[model samples]
Target: MFNELLKERLLDAHLEFFRKDKKKFLIHRILYAVIVAMLYAMVIMVIKMPIWLIGFPAAFFIGWKFAYLKLLSTKKNIDIKNSFLFPQFLQSFIALLPSSGNVYQTLKATLNYTPDPLDKELIKLIQKIENGNDRNAYLAFADYIGSSEAYMVMNMIYQFSEQGVEKESIQELERYIQNLQENKVDELIQHKMNASDKFGLFPILISLFLVIGFAGVIFMHYMTNVTDALNTMPK
Candidate 1:
């Protein structure tokens, strides 16, 4: 029950995270690990002689595909959600240009334009614009991407672009975002280094323990056999 709850919590967190950051690739790694574990269990259950012999490699290939499918599903969801915000950011950023193109005109141009993944999010903003909704609030995509630096930048941009707030406020926001992103990268690198160090120690320790334990058991069995043979040989 505890494990089920924990798994549910983790799935919820991943779903929530994928909803925000469409470009991240960690979801694939998780799915691959899950499928590998499933395949291992499946192999242990096969009863047929030939099938059991082949199950290991067969399960590995099937599990690889299963993992790929899982990763694709997660990516599709992320793409859909991220697509909802593309137009607004594109319009706002383009509007910063010296051209006289109005927001609607810019959106019309973009609708006909081929959208890259990042820019496709603008289509949702265009839909909101056409529906007479608040486009300013739609400009909050930058912060919605799950990065603190991105959120701060979007917040400042949202205030400026949506609420007709001061433009100069964005300068400080930019500086802050730069610093935050740098710090975040440093922290991530340090965390990976620590994880690698811990992982490196595991195989060596496990191998050493297994070797010593197996050798001791074998030595004891050999000694017992020698004593039995000697006792039985004379009288």
Candidate 2:
């Protein structure tokens, strides 16, 4: 009924932004949920009710954990947001390239204008370029960005840095970065839409759970009354 992929992202995140003991907390939640499920089953058995009845309460308890997934998506959204800064950095690098001696210098100068994550990456990039590692520096930068468009932009920069490459490469990089920016916008929009759809399903799930719980209580009461009446008549 909902996207399981989002839940996987939360597991991947490990709740880094929220807790230092994330792994322990995650372990606790999982073990606790499992314990709760088993405890509910035992309760139903003791009450002489159908074991299948455990599914409703367990589903309600565990399913609301989708909320935990929603919180972790915040970290993922922030990561996707950092993707936008790459095009901005590309634009700056292209603009500074004309007066700069090489890609190393352009990357160094861009550091003055860059922000977090990208700025941090550029610092590493500049170090690698200074160490006489040109190709892999750009490659590592692209890998850090982790997208097809990112690899394309890094390749454009690699070409633009060559001694005899055409000046037209600058314009090409500019147009490509523009398109990349537009695509990133679309991606962010789609991401939010998917989250919205997931959130909308929760209310319906909650209502269904409440109805099942009410039915369970009524069933328990009826069985209790029937047992009492039979005991009075026979004994």
Candidate 3:
């Protein structure tokens, strides 16, 4: 089902952060829901409301938290995949291509110097090659990245490996890398603007909430005074 697929993806997204202990992860999630529900139940009891009302907000809050964590993990993965490392990776690949004897050697040389998740991916690609899955390895690397630009780069490399590198092909690959770098710069600027907007909005929201709280307190004091005055008057 669609929901099952979504849940699988969400779990996979957090795999690095949470590790592979499903039982531990489930226990933590359950504790989160239980603690949230208990807090909401306490608030409802204080307000002299029916206990059933607590269940709604508790369930809603748990769903919201799950969605928030899922989104956070997804953004983290995107940041890792689209890191400045990619530009460095492309540059290194291009540089190595000229001196390395073949695509595998070029990739192996690049792997020695590459970082983190990209290095992890290259390891998988190398394993696939060792297992005689060269064709699938290229496609798998593209899928692992989930990037159109990555797919293009991988495909280009595969073509070069098959038909031998051509001047025109290398030139085209360079142009793609240049465009990718430009896109990354634009994305970075947009991220900064978004962060600035969030920072700016937070203070305004906090101030508005504080003003409303103060007004509520003053209104309550005024109403209490009026009631006391009326009780002592001609009534």
Candidate 4:
């Protein structure tokens, strides 16, 4: 079950760059996780902290989270690549629609022009079309893109071919897609800024909490000592 989940994550992340070394990748991640847990356990032991009380689980959780961070970073990179290429790919498809006059033909013509990741998916889509699925293949391709804007663009392309929409409308959609790409870029930047701020704030929050906790402990100890002294002296 865990292996299946990992496989699904790899696929979702579109880490085709790691296709050849998937087993090695899995092995390395597992080893890294184990090493992290072991090092943490040793740290706890050196500090004389009891492992039976939450130490081991915390170490494992830390290790798992750190390993998963690698996956998250890889997915972010792939997503960025796709976002950068998608607008251009859409324009290429739109350009060919007049010549090809059908969605499948337009995509086949666009395949050579398409870049990596998108090209790979295009190849699959073409195969699905050849397999007799027709419109279903096209609709599924939209969903497979895993982007809402991409889905809309693809569906619009299909509608254009089916309904024979005006060239000006196609050109307008092209402009809209270009603007969409620009907006997506701005949104990505904003999200990154928000993430940076959160990450920046997290350490400060942790530090403040730690300081308060230590101060509370010291204050309690001091108050207890004072109370004992007062009790002995007067009463």
Candidate 5:
């Protein structure tokens, strides 16, 4: 009975914390709320100390930073990391496939010929379209992929599905796909360069210096203010 009650409590807590967006943001929000509530209860019931109240906002800041770091780690999950490599290969495979008369056939051909982390996602798109979903569904799926290049390519495909397919349209689509792939590669390279900048350590060191310097200045000012207020008191 006790275990069942604990499980229910945990589930309720999870539902309260859960969000459709980044789970990290939800986690951080929940953590900050819980911490603030606990702190409030403690102040009312246990320690009525002033010093503890000052730490409340700091708790939120720390929780948010930790949540962001956690979200970054999740973004590097196996499927997402594989997505970074799969797009080029998938594009190449799609180019090599024999000309299919319809865009849907072309997608099916690509799915059959290419195997990648994106394959499952593509298959789902195909199923959705087959099940009579509108062209925009595929576009939305591409958007969910969170790749601008993919979105562009998918948007073009959506346009083809709207207008009757033609050889010229297919050629244009191919050209656009190649261009998008190139842009993806360029973006990947830029990301790597940005990552390399992290190894320089300058940003981290400067941030630490600023934080320590600010804290010291605040402490000194606080002491000076307290001293002045005490002196102004009539002897």
Candidate 6:
């Protein structure tokens, strides 16, 4: 019961870090840590090691895993913000612009279907535009996301707002933005493939090590028994 509550609290804290829903990821991380700690404790108990020996390493492992999970989650969030979602956003914005005829109307129409983090940022930008703070809105958005794709999108919007919408230029920019997004997606896919390969090898390596270790222990035991039987034989 106590562990369950602690896990819930940790997940809640993690959820607070992102504008989007990360509860599922947080729960998975917390559960992973707990299971790992429990296995560590079980190993120590089986080895007849002092219970106190489990505390420090278990705590450290939990903390390390949590930090790792946080790092991965943050990277995934950045990827989604800059690469995955932004391209779709740009496409939508570009498509809506020719019809909506203005940055504000385009953003407002896009917001109706946009998801969180992006949606929230768009809301802020819309508010800033409404209050006649276009400069600050652009700056705030660029700084908040700190994504190159976001910067490009914002620049495109700024240009459209100033120079009037040109369909050809907008289409060209959209295609370029989409290409960048595709490249990013490719890089991410390659990274995941590499990681999968590494993970695949890891289990095999661990199994080999365990087998060798257990075999050594059995061999040593067998030799000891043989030596004792020889010594006890009639001579």
Q: Of models 5 and 6, which has the larger lDDT?
A: 6
Q: Which number leads on lDDT? A: 3
Count: clashes, candidate 3: 0
Q: Please give the TM-score that candidate 3 achieves against the real structure.
A: 0.79
Kindly list the per-residue Cα lDDT of model 5 for residues 1-235, writing each as its tens digit: 2343324333333333333354655666678667755666577557666667667766555554444444344544633654465465446535743566666777787776555566776787888889774867777667546666667767767776668666686687677667766866887799889978987788899999999999999999999999999999999
Best by TM-score: 3
Q: List TM-scores for all candidates, in order.
A: 0.47, 0.61, 0.79, 0.60, 0.52, 0.65
What is the Cα-based TM-score of model 1? Answer: 0.47
Model 1, residue 32: C-alpha shift (Å):
14
lDDT of 2: 0.74
- Please report the TM-score between candidate 5 and the true structure: 0.52
Model 4, 140-205: lDDT tens digits are 666556688877777776676567768787888988887987987888899899999999999999
Off by over 4 Å in 6: 1-72, 75-82, 230-235
User: Model 1: how far is 141 from its true place, Å?
Assistant: 3.7
How big is the RMSD of model 5?
10.5
What lDDT is obtained when candidate 4 is compared to the true structure?
Answer: 0.74
The whole-model C-alpha lDDT of candidate 6 against the native structure comes to: 0.73
User: Could you tell me which 10 consecutive residues in candidate 6 have the lowest summed lDDT?
Assistant: 1-10
Model 2 worst lDDT run, 10 consecutive residues: 1-10
lDDT of 3 by residue, 129-188 (tens): 777746678988877666777788888888887888888988898888888888888887
CA lDDT scores, all candidates in order: 0.54, 0.74, 0.76, 0.74, 0.64, 0.73
Report residue 145 deviation for candidate 6 (angstroms): 3.3
Q: Model 6 compared with the native: what TM-score?
A: 0.65
RMSD of each: 9.5, 7.8, 3.9, 6.5, 10.5, 7.2
Per-residue CA lDDT of model 1 for 187-233, tens digit only, reads 66887899899999999999999999999999999999999999999
Q: Tell me how candidate 1 scores on lDDT.
A: 0.54
Q: For model 3, which pairs clash?
A: none
The Cα error of candidate 5 at residue 47, in Å, is 18
